[model samples]
Target: MNLLLIAALIITSIAVLAYIGSMVLQSWLYSVPADKMPLRSFVTALLAGGFLTLWCWIDTKNPGRYDTLFSFSSYDTEDFDVVDAVKKVGEEEKTIRYTRRSVGTKMVYMNDQNQPFRKADAEGAIFALIVTEKDKPVRFITKLDKNGNFPPGEIQYREEGGKRYIDDTMIGRVNRPGTLKVIYVLLLNFGHFLIWTLSLWLVMNYALGHAISIACCLWLVITLLIMPVLFTKTRKQEKVITPQVSFPSVNDPNLSEPEPKDEEKKGTRQFQDSNGNGIAILWIGSAISNS
Candidate 1:
């Protein structure tokens, strides 16, 4: 990736991982509105937000961190799951999908970086991972559905030559623009700030010994660069599908406000402006990083 893009990622990550996440946590957990919250609340929420993110991160067991001094804290990883190592040895510059055909493992191990073969810990199926050197458009998979429930999947078990085998596949779930599921995910995206903050600390520690690397991770600088764009975009997308809601004065009764557009009323679609909270930058960053 180019320095410009990397710079963008560091900036985007910090904004969501701190400012925005802090604001939400303080408002919900502390019952303090964002405008009235203090600086320390932001920092404290930043720490608290990452508690879940850190738990999730550690759940991955960091299989690739094995070579470092933190190896003892890391767990064994497969070649397909390794991240830091590069796959420049082969002539194939094209993208690839890797898999294993072992007794209990299906397709696994895209030979990039140290990504390891995924074994069927229980029952498994055509475990899919599509990777490419060429950058192309992709989509986001919301792990949670609209009601914050796990999406459906198919996992079948069988016995092959006395060896237990498992098979699985993801049932498709799309959170398109204006969908409640999309909004839910957009809301959950703030939790990612904690993970980013934790990552920032680890990265800063390493870059502290290297001056040039330090320049790449100035979060405050990048946030300044991005804030204006966010401001303009937010204002533009604040429009409502229904007529503008006019809450009556406390003296007036509040009832079913108004009917939405036909599309929204049909239950087929709803209107939600970009619903951006200045966090889509992280989406771009993650997509870029994966590429």
Candidate 2:
């Protein structure tokens, strides 16, 4: 089904989107001066988060890289661990060892000699890994062995059964039943975006998309709706100019001199408001005729 190719495409798409989103978020935080966190702290935190996201993307696109890092080698059924119960009374302790065939958290890299090559284990559980050589699949198996030590590794099962060379038979280590490690490995292999189990729990109680939408709506409400309050709480009022008339004293000698008889009969107008607000309203008739 070319599942690996599909997985790669999905991982790449999400990674690019997340990277862009984080950049945008960082920019938005910078622009809001009132709600802004320290620039250095915000940048450092965001960079760390982005780096983790990038690693997750790489791991998804190339699952083999993580397998080589953590998934232990696959083993056969003959190596499955077994223990005899010593129960001589009622209510004995749980006995049978639980085993499941899946991908290993550790991966093996061969250095051209088909020998186990050294690689660091990713500090997390890994489920399935697709192994290939020259773009061809390899066969691997995960089964118990006679020694009671369940080790996962590449398998040569049914290689001589008229089958073409394939490496798709590798199996991962068996995890203990009802253990966090087991659950962690299983969830990691789900190949979906990893988040808190509590979120998944909420999704169980409520629909995933609905829960996600609610979260987004809450975020918007906080960011957009509360911005005014934030600004009001953090801001100081600035003084702004309100225009009013200012009169300048006239010192012309003509103002002090007596007028001629004909002009004396014409009365001069005084600009004033009966309300006594000290705002002068110009007597414009004289000014217009003069202009």
Please state every model's RMSD to the true fold in angstroms. Answer: 31.1, 32.9
* Candidate 2 lDDT over residue span 1-291, tens digit each: 233443344345434543454345535644432222233323433442333344344444543223211351232122222211111122332221122323376443333334332111222111122234355533322233544233466533232222332232222222222344345434443322223222322322224554355345433443344323332332344668899996655886655757657544443222233433333334455567789
Stretches of model 1 off by over 4 angstroms after superposition: 33-291
Cα lDDT of model 2 overall? 0.34
Candidate 1, 97-213: lDDT as tens digits: 444323354543333443553323222222222322136322122233444333467433222222222232311211122344334333333334433444434432222322223
Residue 151, candidate 1: C-alpha displacement in angstroms:
47
Q: Give me the displacement of residue 206 in model 1, in angstroms.
A: 26
| TM per candidate | 0.17, 0.17
Error of 1 at 171 (Å): 41
Candidate 2 C-alpha error for residue 194, in Å = 5.9
Worst 10 residues of 2 by lDDT: 80-89
Q: Give the range where candidate 1 is weakest over 10 consecutive residues by summed lDDT.
A: 80-89
